[model samples]
Target: MYENNLLLERGAARDLPETILLSDFLLDCQVRNFSPRTVQSYKSNLKYFLSRHPIRISPEDLKVFLVHIRDEKGFAQSTVENYFAALSSFNDFLEWEGVIERNVVPQFRKRYLRQYKDQRNEERQLINLEQMRDLIDSAEWICHKAMFVFFAKTGIRRQELIDLDVQDLHVSKRYAVLKPHAKRSNRIVFFDDECAQVLETWLKWRYNRKIRISALFIGVQGSRISRDAVYEAVTEHGLQLGFHNPEGLLNEKFTPHCFRHWFTTWLRRAGCPRAIIQELRGDTRKEAIDIYDHITQDELKEDYLKYIPKLGIKL
Candidate 1:
């Protein structure tokens, strides 16, 4: 049960002059089964635009408001387009409820001819077989070794791995469902015989330590491994292997997401279909799934073997 605490605040209607009651619109979206993350984004964007442009004005004034944001506020064309989308949905809701007679936001589309593109582009980093082997061989902690092997094999998102709970992994079923902090998607990743065996070995080692923890991976405080911890673990191990200098390898710009990108790229080169690769990475976008539609699992397995020959355990 999501409370409407954030959506509706006291005197919000009176204080917010131009903006509609966005909470109502968000509730509608929720009822329609839109993903929670999508609803949150819509709410955030709409509130940001409206709060910044809060002035008593007619529907026709939206054009001037948009131009002001673009020219004076220095918002990029793409960001402005996203603002229009958020407001358009809210305005449509208002129009339906008799708050306004005309769809002013929809008219902006024809007036501005705005084009929207995703701005959160990710950079690609390919960690080849040799680099991965070196990192694994240098791992001082058995748990860290398991973490490296799990990431190298599965390509789970950094957040997904961070969010992994011991109970979430059903070894008998050969699958794990990771619920990430993001609301966009949940990932269900499979584990083959090799990964399972390594995981089992790590679990045995953990048991011998006689510590109680629900997280598959834990930090110094016995809490779940965070993004920072996982990253440090990877970088430290890589540096220990002499594959990279401490300063050169753990640069701020390079991060766990790079591992995910490398994993996906490797999968594509191995001949796995784009859809399968996207599915493996827990991506929900159809466009993302279409890019590598020509690959096969057999080719991917062969590629993995060529790179990590020590992984003699077969699927």
Candidate 2:
């Protein structure tokens, strides 16, 4: 089935060069709408394997590779998971293309990324509603204040915030369009009027200065802000506001995704249904994501308004 790839004789899977097979697998990943990051991971991991191991892979060889990475390389649980995922997908692709007769990757699933202990409870990374307001107050600049407000109120992922454009802010509707990031899934997220006011104020200040950039958020130099800058800004303010875990014992830092989690947790505490919260966060549940389509924006907004605070306007 690798029609465009090297024409290997039937049952001659070992004769196929790993690079050529990897090329075919990568093309398939692209066709299947895998993210560029994922494709790159597959390419790098497979090429690394080829660099170290024989072109022809067997179940026995795969077991050795796994041990080498997990034990010898001292890979963490997540790294081991990622490596095997790459291997599994690559093997599946080759098997599907008839290059291999058996799918051995599945048999190795139990050992791959195996964990012995239950997940450790890291301090609750999210800020409370009061802490959120305090975090916003800790911002030194108008732009930082607006960014803090949006992150706290909107609950969008950091990447979504980075990809945000000025045009995506529908201030009049009190919502922002979160363009698809991971999985190419896009959805609307709502925020309170307090956020709207700050964003509008920022826009006014931004326009008055004649900064022609189209980015929604800009740094001191009037260019689009980098992800690291946003993280540092949040962390810097979070520490000042004393954002610790539930026990309030450790100096836990808040992350961008924390806002998203904070939003869900707050919504749940506010009596919003788990299904609706999942819809807002773009997470699919078994009950069917389409069921949420019946929940109108007006209803969503009304439910959201009941929970988030209506902060006083800050210019």
Candidate 3:
């Protein structure tokens, strides 16, 4: 029995190649039922790290890798953070498998990445109500108009908007059921009559086209719109209306995300309650009080209709 126990312990502690470890870690991610996108992200990040440093991961080597990505490769702060997150998850897996005594990625992040304040929020473009109207009106295509109104009124992320299906919308109800997203806490978003009208017109036009796809929005070829296409459509209209400047700073340029900023800002200007705005924006409840503050869908819709600005879209 003593010899058998020794053999079990030795097998448990057997050394594995870094590549084998990475494959195992990824398999663990799959076993946990992580989304395909998430699993792909982990695989990509780990593969890049392994390609650079083919040996065992150490805190010092990790630091060097991070510096190389941040400084030499000029990756954005968010991208760098994503890389760190992948590494941290992998380290946790290693520690769980007894490959390491403890995970050090959290400590490394606190000592390095967590010190800087993210200024992207501060530098986001803020357009006024009239300018928003101009942007909607200037759209050459009905699809573009509907998309802009949806973004400005709903304040959903680009990916969320793109993921919307035809069945998710209730045109008469002036509401939409957004697809599941990691960051979005609430899946419901409401729009005003102006937005509804534009959407109805787009739907009619889309029906005329007779595209059989389930996507709420589509391209010229009757396929679900790509992310780049959405970006281009928004930017094109923004430039035409002088709301976007490609040569300007982050604050001076209007992007699809700017609509979300506009929605939040205007809702506050209209004196919407913080909790109501939070619910409408699908923001995660972070505090203990937030957990108990349950605002009903009816209340949310009532406040939303009262606060959502009128763009006077003449469709």
Candidate 4:
């Protein structure tokens, strides 16, 4: 009798509409400090699933939905995986809240989605030194030039770059402190004299404009620059130099992330030791030995300055 009662209670808990549960989940995401873009993505993916199925979902229902999206809707494999990820997260929430007896999405993914997953590796675009120099030189604005130089010098992720504030940068010291992130092992990144020169020029121009925002990079209205703006800026310069092709594969088009590849590749070529390069890249240490291998700031800066490539752009 107790077992039957427990089953009834679980069913009743799941009777709540999908929209209500989604709202609660999104609220929890906000409380956990998820970025706005990520929360919106979760919301959209869950809404699409709810449109086809009720909140009281079963493993069979999930399998059918995945098949429909992949086979009938003809979504890309990655996009299908994204939809499943959103559903899997929601299932975890349901299980945690006691609305469901167990989360089945994980098992379903392993059984159904794993077999079809793509295993091929994709290559990224890597421009040579002369091309990189020409790309930076062709930028019409000091701000764009500084941004390009900074990305090449620091090898930080795009979001990390966007999160920068004027206070985070120490121009005289030729280094900047990146914000804390789960994936980053180091918070400090150093720049060379060329990068510092371009940054100083941009800062001087920005200060004269009387912009009051603390962001290191700003849009026309003195607001923080968005990710889209950065992509467009990089693409514009890339296209002008015949380096970015809209109809090309991943390796054929130049993007902001390519700067990181260029940085890592050239530093390796310059004979910067593997440990030092990893430290400068801020990659999380995975090995047990990696945790014990400490690279001091001064040492890192010295090697970074020694190895970082120069673009030969006249200030």
Candidate 5:
């Protein structure tokens, strides 16, 4: 397990003290190809437990720790469930290593009992064609315009956009490579003609300027733009266009994940096959695509044209 620390040279949290056992478990997760985000969440949950409940003993101590979280911390049922998951994994590792004889963390399920009715009927909050046009028209900077165009058309997650490399954009294929360190490893996402045109224009303008950064989106000093910058850009744009409010709305409600949601939802409304949608969105399960992917391009075009102005380009 101590050897596991070497593999985490790039990813481990520096502020936290090193643990041979914890490092080993994390290394195992990495070997399993679990998404970095999932690994981080699991690590965070385990770290929080270790920080608060620092007692070293047999497996029975774990059961006592769970009870304390439930009875004393007043943590939500879901949060407690996550804590149980973290500890359960740790206990299993200890046993496998022969450090402990038994595993005692009880498995528990999480449920959210809503007091009020679900608001799903509320119109799916997506940027319609008109709102999208307004957003593009109002963008004052080339960077902001390019960023909005990239997301609105490609429908990638925020982190994916942050990690995007210039080489990832396959202009000939009309697709962009979305290879994030977390979640979906590498997915090919296609874009529309208008977005391609917008990006080409931006690239031309940028090329003439003397920027030598390899990153698609460069910040001051020619550094790659961070995820936070993209978040801020989208949030400000949404607010300026009255698409969403700056406070409590815009990004807080619609986040970078929402763009992917919008894409999936739009594809469903447009009548794309569930299998195709799943393939496009990099979803592992086909059940959701089956449930939602029932529309066709013709039907979707008819529905969308009612809201989205004439694209002039045929689908």
Candidate 6:
């Protein structure tokens, strides 16, 4: 029996409603410390699925739903894939809970990536060092300013950024463990002395406030910051630093993810080896593990320092 906890509402029924089951699944995700953004996506997607189908769905119904979503609803391949992923997860949960005897869904997952390869954005957008400095300097809070520096120096995803904790930073070593969130891998990301100084300033403020959260970055409300808040803040400042690009459809300056792209571009321009760049960028480890297996964090930091962003402009 699932307990009334977190977002789950209380009910007086022995048999769990689909609503309660979904709530339980979300709680399970929270227990595993999944990102709030990811949990929200899963809940939204799976609820949409349940609205179309019953608590128990046949393989035929799943295939029909997939076809309807693709042809009638005209959902993009990627959106369909997201729906497929959430439904598959729900199916797995149901099977585990013994609510269903078998696990089968529309094979909406297969070939979605490969078939829509050209449709996706592979653009490697970049911003100049000057613009990077402006975004960092524009941040009002010292903590947000430090976070801006962290993004500019390290090519971590938004998910990975929020996953960061104070313990992850090693000032003496000039490196931080950028733990995996979403598609990223648990890896070391090194920042320069300049970023460290800014971070320490924020740390002093954070320590004085004494917020009881483990998150490295917190909002003015003294709580762990949400991913949407980070995105909005980064975009708000980044837009002032660079011009819009009509060709790419997404200007680097208008997105928090642009920092990661810019970091990769700068690292390559600095002549860091492809393998080292891949490691620092947290590329999909499925193929590059053999190449990076022997590499040490010390060696990586040496390479990281050689071409670290030199923003003379301070926050």
Candidate 2 has an lDDT of: 0.75
Residue 267 lDDT (model 3): 94
Q: Model 6 segments beyond 4 Å from truth?
A: 1-17, 20-40, 58-80, 92-106, 109-117, 121-124, 180-184, 208-212, 242-248, 251-253, 284-293
* Evaluation by lDDT, superior candidate among 2 and 6: 6
* Model 1 spans > 4 angstroms off: 1-123, 180-186, 241-254, 285-315
Candidate 4 residue 39 Cα shift, in angstroms, is 2.5
lDDT of each: 0.65, 0.75, 0.86, 0.87, 0.62, 0.76
Per-candidate TM-score against the hidden true structure:
0.55, 0.76, 0.86, 0.87, 0.65, 0.75
Give the worst 10-residue stretch by lDDT in candidate 6. Answer: 5-14
Over 1-315, each residue of candidate 6 has an lDDT whose tens digit, in order, gives 354442233222225889988998898889878777778999999888888888788867777887889889999776887887788787777766667766675354553334665666656456787877877888778877998889889878887888788898887778888775656654778889898899888888877877668899877676777788888788667555554333335443367778887898888888888878877887655566654576677787888899776897475
Question: Which ten contiguous residues of candidate 2 have the minimum total lDDT?
Answer: 112-121
Candidate 3 global lDDT? 0.86
Return the clash pairs for model 5, or none: 270-300, 271-295, 271-296
Ranking by TM-score: 4, 3, 2, 6, 5, 1
In model 2, residue pairs whose N, Cα or C atoms come closer than 3 Å (at least 3 residues apart or on different chains), thus clashing, are none
Taking all chains together, the TM-score of candidate 4 against the true structure is: 0.87
**Lowest-scoring 10 consecutive residues by lDDT in candidate 1?**
306-315
lDDT of 1 by residue, 125-182 (tens): 4556666666666676777777877786777767678768888887765567787544
Ranking by lDDT: 4, 3, 6, 2, 1, 5
Residue-wise lDDT of candidate 2 within 24-103, one digit each (tens)? 78999999888666898888888877787775467778878878887999986667677778888988887776777777
Candidate 2 wrongly placed segments (more than 4 Å): 1-17, 47-49, 54-76, 116-124, 141-143, 181-186, 208-210, 218-229, 239-253, 288-293, 310-315
Q: Kindly give the number of clashing pairs for every candidate.
A: 4, 0, 0, 0, 3, 0
User: For candidate 6, what is the TM-score?
Assistant: 0.75
